[model samples]
Target: MTTQVQSGGMVNTTLMGGGALLVVGLGLALANLMTGGHASFNSGSDGVTWGLPVVNYVFFALTSTGLTLVASLALTFGNKAFYPIAKRCVFLSLITLVAGFASLALELGHPFRMLFAVPLNFQVNSPLNWMGVFYAVFLVLGVLKFMKLHASDWDSDTSKQVGLAALVTECLAGGMLGMAFGAMAMRPMWYGTLVPLYFLLTAACTGGAFALLMTYLTYGSESAMPEKVRALVQGPLPAALAAVLGFTILVMGYQTVIGLWSNADGMQVWDHIVSTPWFWIEAGALVAAFYLLVSRSSLMVAAMLIILGLFINRYEFVIGGQLVPLFKGTWVAGMISYTPSITEWMLTVMAFGIVLAGWAFGEKAFNLSDAPKE
Candidate 1:
């Protein structure tokens, strides 16, 4: 009854799991509202905690940004190698960007202020304010691109130019968050030259992961992609996975080093994260995820584990980054211990739900599983 795409390499069930995960993530939100985050965040105990919700913001941004990068490689650059997946990449990037925004909104204590304040008040120093500007510009350009897709006269040179311009703006806007991290002179943890590149590399992996899952769900195992897609994905996916893994180690290794010598905040964070047993759990999951790339039997298991690793990475980053004595002098090793509060946790769960629901809605809106036939 339905149309066919690829033929027989992927397992149909993996796609099913992807759908189920969407539900589970969403379902957790409802459960959280009913039962509560179970983890309390007393402001007295944790300080005015921002929690992992912000990390979700970063992750969502990574996902969207990565998709945008890959899409650009395919479309604007005229890379025939990437064309098969270009459309899906663009649409998926859009989906992830929206989800990231949703998560950020949920995490905010003053969401209404952010929404209304920027346009009215306009503070440029605030990264959030700049992001608002970025988002508005990107959204307008994106609409222009979307319009080209539906327009009968899209083949006209003017329309193509508009689409191309939109894609470029999207990438720049999408990269804003990543650049923000790298450009922070005050935060030693975030200031590394490689941090922005790290963001881009991980973004590609996340985007590829999303595409793979989408393809699996729609076509189920037998994707008879053009030779270009075949080569690009086969080489690209593993490369991304490896780069991300290496970047995680580099970041963590520096922390471990800092903790041993200096009483720096990042070092202090290193102490907590490394000292914990869950550190191994996180590390092990990442290793296993990368290892699965070479395996034929259980890519799904590995993918699941990698996703778990990603979550732990985010969790550690969120919790560990704040645990450091931010305001206190270097002599004070620990001024904060962070545990997510019920509100923070609930918001995270809700954010996950929103992402899943949004993705599901996204699938119906665009043929996110299909790329342009090269």
Candidate 2:
């Protein structure tokens, strides 16, 4: 017996539940769009432009990039220890990127127009344009890579080549996503070389965390996993997470210190940021997660904490950067306060629902555990 790993009942239930969430969320989102348009969102015309939707976009986008980078360890670098999970990582990357794009489509005023407008009116000097182009390429490459992997049953030289290309594309796309914020000269808080580097770092952390999380969810426990796969999970996975978390902490600490010391125009936003309980909570969660990983306490707990903290971190980074009004004493007086509307919340639910349902379906349909032959 091959230790029948398919938990059919559980997988089916998850699929149905996720599908229900997807329907409910999409119905609400469409209703909102039909009624009030983008005005339904909490984002104002003057103060806060990018709101929760953008945060959601960044969260999923970076996470997808992270998964691609993680998968590259095996596909591109030929790391045998990582082979078992590489297929899952690539599949999740595709699903999550689709989710991110869906959220962005909901956010944009005219989503379909972008399909043609971007290429027709390409602006080389614009970081946003480059970000869009890179991501578009990345999405296409991701699809091709997944197709190759699936067709070859996760073993092919051609798939490896595509994986290598995907790794490079993801780096460019991830960096561009950061540059989309860092390149904004008007937003002092977001402008810096650190933003892109931080994005890449967090991408790794989030990607690794998600991969670990899904592995645990699928296997239920270490004993359920194949002997060799379990060894890889216990040894290499947590070790990689630990190393990335260490670097992430250092970068976050330095970013905070720099924010505190800088007397730039929008730097005052940090004052408000440091005062909030969420800020400390975000930092605390990462610290706890790091400790858990190093202490060999629980990889599951660490993964959950890292995901939670990174979500909050993304929320803060997106909203906090815009809190300080560009023009003082105008219609916007002090720090702009924004609360995500129910519509925005529903969109987020929709994104999660899509990911949950897709992942569950993939698990039930595909042999995600089939390790590549040496």
Lowest-lDDT window of 10 residues in candidate 1?
1-10
Best by TM-score: 2
State how far residue 65 of model 1 sits from its true place (Å): 0.5
Cα-lDDT of candidate 1: 0.58
Q: Give the TM-score of candidate 1.
A: 0.75
TM-scores, all models, native as reference: 0.75, 0.95
Q: Model 1 has how many clashing residue pairs?
A: 10
Model 1 regions more than 4 Å off: 1-48, 146-167, 179-187, 191-194, 222-261, 294-302, 327-335
User: In candidate 2, what are the lDDT values of residues 1-374, reduced to their tens digit?
Assistant: 12244574345666788798889988998899889999889998777899888898999989999999889987889787887788779888988888888989999988999889988988898877887777788888888987776665454767777788888888888899999999888888899876888899999999999888887777777778877778777888888999998999888888888888999988888888889998899899999999988876788889989998998889989998999987757667688878899999888888878877888888877656555555
The CA lDDT at 172 in model 1 is 59
Clashes of each: 10, 0
Q: Name the weakest run of 10 consecutive residues (lDDT summed) in model 2.
A: 1-10
**Which pairs of residues collide in candidate 2?**
none
